[model samples]
Target chain A: MKPINEMKLEFVSKSSNESFARATVSAFIAQLDPTIAELADIKTAISEAVTNCIVHAYKSSIGKIYITVQIFENGKSIIKIRDKGCGINNIKQAMEPLFTTGGDERAGLGFAVMQSFMDKVRVSSKPNKGTSITLEKNIIPRFIKNGQPS
Target chain B: MDVKIKLTGNTLTACIEGDIDHHNAKEIRECIDQKIEEESPNLLELDFSKVQFMDSSGIGLIMGRYKLMHILDGKLQVINIPENIKKLIKLAGLASLNIIKE
Candidate 1:
């Protein structure tokens, strides 16, 4: 197995940076042999993760969010998102479906969507330290009828 | 983003194209709200057939439109949701909104 190649990006926790983060992740994932549907799924998952950091992690503080993307030759992709801000107190409660922290115009579904799109998701947080989310997906290459990759 | 507003009798259709992220949500919001106000349609349909992508900002846009429709006593419907976007919408517990697929 080849070592996974990684890309890292750091940006301010502003709404405007959301698109930048999403686009960055999309371009990184596109290097892999992912289908259009898979690309869309990965992009949406990245968007949700980055948006969560901007909206909930920093809350009212001025901070930056870091995102890392890694892709393996075996078609496995991993994304790690971290924020150096007020961390979540109860990660379990936060992962519960439809349980938003309130007043952020969120549907409490960011984590849920991330989990649904990716094959694996792990979230770790410390009360006053920070929060880190890792997402992994094993991409299945799509093939054309002529025995060529699509 | 480009929003095309069409009115037929009491129904208003908004065809949305391009990406719906934080970058263009404000323009989309204004366009849709303007159409809602000017047409005063009893039914509002948001067509996403041409939309390439959407993020949480798109969810915010939908929520705002839902609230506006509630205030006007009109029905809001979303059509032609792509599979990837459908996953986000479902995960967000927005299926209760009963977005129609075509």
Candidate 2:
């Protein structure tokens, strides 16, 4: 799809970068003038996706994490976060809540959180290749008290 | 994340600031856990008035603290949860479990 606006960011798979990635995406999406609630949803979903890449994909060792965001003229958004590390063997089980492999520290709710916040989440992975997560959110157009689009 | 603990009587209130994610959840967990061990308060209150962002990791942080308080025969309460963060907590079914007091 030809995006009216797009951004690509690459960073090392480190826990600290999770916040960075979320902030970057949130700032970029701010151009749409989304509601604070909508902005929070996007930031939280991005945080979960980036954290998954750091904890599950990279697993402590540093690797590359790529984030691509595209916004269409209609205010729809598509965000893709990819990691070239250990791929998920079972996407279904992995998406289940409270089924984490990152030990007690992890709540195993990353994918579930993503699914809850975004309109749609699609995951693709190969055993040894890598994992890619695509998130989509349909923007809720804002309106003024005059019953007109802001 | 920055954590400040206030102890009054048997209640301990922890004021947390900044974002909560996997990177700093461990640190936040350890900080609060250490205080719980030291004070052994009967009530634990998590103040999120200053928290601007949180994710699933925040849920895990609260869950870990709740279990700890339960083991100690204490109660856990979450106060001043912003609407956005509250949504994530509810999504985790924590509200249904009554683990968090709004």
Predicted structure with the largest lDDT when compared to the true one: 2
* Candidate 1 Cα errors over 4 Å, as ranges: A102-104, A141-150, B90-96
Give the chain B TM-score for each candidate.
Answer: 0.94, 0.95
Per-residue C-alpha lDDT of model 1 across residues A1-150, encoded as one tens digit per residue:
654688889888887787788878888888776887788888888888887887778888769899888888778888999998889988889988767774434556677778888899999999888999999987775563237965
Interface C-alpha RMSD after superposing true interface residues, each candidate, one decimal:
2.5, 0.8
Top TM-score: which candidate number? 2
Q: In model 2, which regions exceed 4 Å deviation?
A: A143-146
What TM-score fits each model?
A: 0.86, 0.96
Candidate models: Cα lDDT each: 0.81, 0.89
Q: Write the per-residue lDDT of candidate 2 for residues A1-150, one digit (tens) a residue.
A: 578899999999978898889999999998877888999999999998999888889886899999999998777999999999999999999999899998876788998889989999999999878999999997765664237966
lDDT of 2 by residue, B24-73 (tens): 99999989999999999999999999998999888888888888899999
The DockQ values of the predictions, listed in order, are 0.48, 0.82
Model 1's interface RMSD: 2.5
